[model samples]
Target: MRALFWLLSIFALAAGLAIVARYNDAYALFVWPPWRLHISLNLLAILSVGLFALLYMATRLVARALALPGAVAAFRAQQRKQRSIQALRDAQRFLVEGRYGRAHAQADAAYRANESPGLAALIAARASHAMREHVRCEEWLRRAAEHDREVRVARLMTEAEFAVADRRFDVAAERLDALRQGGHRHIAALRLSVQTAAARGMWGDVLRLARQLASHRAFTAEQAAPLVRRAHLESLRELEGNPEGMVRYWRQIPKPERNDRGLVRDAALLLNASGQGELAAEAIGDALDDNWDSALAELYGRIEGGTLIERIGQAERWLRAQPRDERLLLTLGRLCLQQQLWGKAQSYLEASLSVAPSRAAHLELARLAEQLDRNELALKHFRSAAELTG
Candidate 1:
């Protein structure tokens, strides 16, 4: 529509000029010093218009020629940027495809092209690590640190993980310490620290990190159970020489873990050895209350001191509920023996034998006979105990 308007305007102007030209005949004379020339005014106007059009075209051509170099530079820059983006994308794809060599190549190209240089370098480093090119991996990590300071957290995390993979626990620990000092204690970093600490046999750190992660719901109960249990077991061994330390640690363990039969058994044995019979008995009593195990009942009898009446009463109560449990009866007998109630001890041991003639029951009866100075009965019980292969 705009083109049509301009076209009509041009035609109208031409017709007006034609009518004017037709109505009047005009001429102009140009005189040079030596010659004189005559021309029409309309022709002079046409000549001036033609000269203006030629000059305009000439100026446009010159301007285009002068701007050509800058235009070409801008075009090349755009092309490089596109190539760099493609390289970075291809690198990520190759990394996911497990083509380490190709991923490293593409990432190197991206880095050289300066497209997200820090990210490119880290990608190359990961690929190198996968390929077992340790030197190259370290070099790329160094380049990553140099290229972008903002990626310090990422670089340190990567370095620490790779070091852990290599079993260079000390190096991994150092990297993690540096990361913590830099104040990047996100869940992922904490998880990595857990792995590193576990690898280095740093059970203390493992326990601390596991608890922290658990609070954040970072792992489910099923997933965290073994980790927490292992940490506790290791920590137990760590405090082997410090009985008070063991006591403090035991009390801090959650109630559910304290009810684990296996854990309670180990803990009881350790506590007994450390002269903490009361706590040991308490732990055993708590575990037995949760779940009955014959082995734990037997272990209960072996613990000698620490509120003997309480432990005896607890065992007798369990015996009331499980009258035929030989191990529980034997434990009752042992507890009676500890309190010097010879008649009760002998009676319980005999009842245990009547229920199930086990070697442990006979052995306890034999010990009771000796305590009461019945040599013939002690000899008979000893011979009976010798026949069983317990």
Candidate 2:
């Protein structure tokens, strides 16, 4: 529609000009060097318009010629940039595919092209590490650091992972420490630190990180259970033979962990081994009141050197709640025996044997019979215990 309008306007203007030229006679005369010349004003105006159009076309041609070199250079630069981007993408794909050699080559190409050089160098470093080219890996990491300061965290994390993989726990620990000091303690870093500590047998560190990871939801409660349990158990084991240290360590554990029956039981046993029998008995008594474990109840009776009356009272209270538990009866019998309550001890031990027929119960009854000077009863109980042991 616009083209039609322009065509019609041009025709109308031409018709009007033709009508004017035909009706009005206009002339122009010029002389130079004694020569006379004459031309119509319309012809002179037509020549002037044609000359302006030619000059405008010539100027445009000259401008285009002058700008050609820069345009060609821009096109070449665009091609190089595209190639660099493609190389970077290829490097990423190869890395994911586990094609370390190809990935390293592609990443090197990308780095040479200066396309995100830091990230490319990091990729190269990882590939080199995968291929066991330690020297090359270190060099690439150094280059990555030089190229981009923003990749410092990434560089350290990668190095720490490799250190862990190579069993260089000290190196991994150093790297993790640097990460923490630099405020780079993300979930990934925390996980790596946990693994490093575990590999180094740094149980205390492992326990600390496992708690942190659980709180951060890095792992579910079920998934983190074994790690938490093992770390805490191992840490307790390290405090063996030192009653003061064991007590201090137990006190230092979080209340929730300290309250765990398994932990409490182990801690108590360790305390018992360290000759803190009173403390050991106290720990077991508190745990039994909160939650009952048959094995733990049995362990409670083995603790000595505490107040016999108080311990007997504690066992009797538990018996009221668990009337039929054979282990509880056995524990009560042992505690009564320690207090020299022969009649009560014999009755409880016999009741335990009636309930479970355990060798331990029979043996305890045999000892009680011997204390009462009943050689015949003691011999009978010992024979029964031997049969049960068989």
Candidate 3:
């Protein structure tokens, strides 16, 4: 299409020139000292136009020649920019592919080229650490730190992670504390904080951080359960000697978690071990009220505190709801035994045996039989208990 258009244009121009030349009755004369020259006006016009065209072409060529060096410089700069970008990209890929040595080299190249220097240095640091080049890793991390405005937060987080991996909890804590000073309790940071706290035996912090992470949806309930449970266990242990602290911490825990069988058992046992058996009984009773756990029911029979009659009454109430529950029947029988209602203890124990036999119920019956001086019956119960244990 363009060729056809140019062809028509050229033909139009030639035809117009032909018409002008055919109608040319005009002339121009020029006189010199010894020569006179005559020229057609149309001819003169053609020559003048031809000369202008030559000059335009010459000007364009000179301009291009003058710009040559700068153009070459620009082209080279663009090539370097592309190379730097490619190096940065390759470094990241190598890091992901586990090519630590190559990653470090490429990252270093990127840093020298000044392409996102902070990110480049951090990549180098990570690669160095992966290669077990501790000295080089630290050096790269320091270099990354120099670009503080660009990656201070990233550098700190990376260092904290490395510290945690090395079991340097104290150092990890220091780094995490620095992050906190900057108001960064971001999800990832909170996760690191959880590890640091747990490793340092800072159970309270572990609980707090785990809860925060869960709330942020960084962990699913199923995933968070074990962590939260562990933190509670450790926290209870930490307060083993401090009855008040243990109670306070227990109350501070979310009410829903108080019903967790494992956590409730641990808390109760710890309270009992610390000479706070009354609190232990209260915790167990409260947990049983919220939700029936056979293990907790069995534990309830052993904790030596609270009003024996009240516990027996509580067990009776649970019996109405779970009549076939052997653990509850056993608990009721033990409570009755403690209250010295020998006949009632005997009846409840027999009922528990009918529901399901347990070593605990047999042992309780053995003790009751001994109290009553029934030698043969006591011997029978003792043998049963041993058999169940075996």
Which clashing pairs does model 3 show? none
The C-alpha stretches of model 2 lying farther than 4 A from their native spots are 1-62, 148-150, 197-241, 324-326, 337-390
TM of each candidate vs. truth = 0.71, 0.75, 0.86
lDDT of each: 0.88, 0.88, 0.89
lDDT: worst 10-residue window of model 2: 250-259
lDDT of 2 by residue, 298-330 (tens): 998989769999889889999999988999999
Q: Please report the candidate that would top lDDT against the real structure.
A: 3
Evaluation by lDDT, superior candidate among 1 and 3: 3
Q: Which digits, one per residue and each the tens of the lDDT, describe model 1 over residues 42-99?
A: 8988899999999999999999999999999999999999999999999999999999
Instruction: Give the top-scoring candidate (TM-score).
Output: 3
Worst 10 residues of 3 by lDDT: 203-212
lDDT of 2: 0.88
**Which candidate order results from sorting by lDDT in descending order?**
3, 1, 2
- Report the poorest 10 consecutive residues by lDDT, candidate 1: 219-228
How close to the true structure is residue 381 of candidate 3, measured as C-alpha lDDT? 96
